[model samples]
Target: NYNVLEQVYDVTKFLEDHPGGDEVLLSATGKDATDDFEDVGHSSTARAMMDEFYVGDIDTATIPANVKYTPPKQPHYNQDKTPEFIIKLLQFLVPLIILAVAVGVRFYTKSPSA
Candidate 1:
C-alpha cells in the first residue's frame, strides 16, 4: 500500500510495471510517498493512470504517531549575514534616496520665486 496526499493506492500489481523498479515502490510502503512521487515529476498520463490503482483515503486515526511522514531536514547555512544584509539594504535605500532627492529637487524648482 502506498499513501500519497492522504489517499491510499494499492500498487501491488503495478510493482513489475514501475519504470524505476519495484524496489522504489516497495521502499515507499507503510509511509507517505507524496514527496517521492512528486520528485519523479511523473507525466500527466502517468498521473492519470494512478487513478486505476486508487484504493481509498487513509484513516489518519489508524496511523501511528511515529509512522507519520516527516519531511527531510534542510541544511543550515551561515547565520552571520550582516554584510550581505547591509549590502541589500543599501541597494534598496540608495535607489529610494535618489528618487526622493529627485522629487524634492523637482518640487523646489517648480515653486514660484518669492
Candidate 2:
C-alpha cells in the first residue's frame, strides 16, 4: 500500500531540485498518479492543492465567444519514408526467426524433473 506520509517527506526533499516548478510536485500529493497499482510497491493519495498551490494565481479565463486559437502551419517538407514490400517482409521475418530459434533451444535444453 502507498504511504502518504512517506511520500510527503520524500517529495519535500526532492522539491528543491525540481526543474519545472515545486508547485507541480506539491499539487500531485492527494491525486492518484499510479496507473497500475497491482504491480506497484508504494502508493499515495494526492491532495487537491492544484487549485491552492499551482504555478499561477487563479483567475477566470476570458475567451470571447468568437475567439478561436490560431492553428499552426503544417510542415510542407516531405522525406517520403515509404518502404518497399520486400523490406517490410524481411523485417517481420527476422524477429519470428529469432524467436523460433530461442524456443527451439529452450525445448532442447529442458529435462524432466523428479
- Angstrom error of the Cα, residue 55, model 2: value is 48
Please list the residue runs of candidate 1 whose C-alpha ends up more than 4 Å from where it truly belongs after superposition. Answer: 1-5, 66-114
Give the clash total for candidate 1.
0
TM-score of 2: 0.27
Write one digit per residue (lDDT tens) for candidate 2, span 17-114.
65546776577665443332234333343334322333332222332337677999997754445466668777999999999999999999999779
TM-score of 1: 0.51
User: What lDDT would each prediction earn against the true structure?
Assistant: 0.88, 0.53
RMSD of 1: 13.2
User: Which candidate has the highest TM-score of all?
Assistant: 1
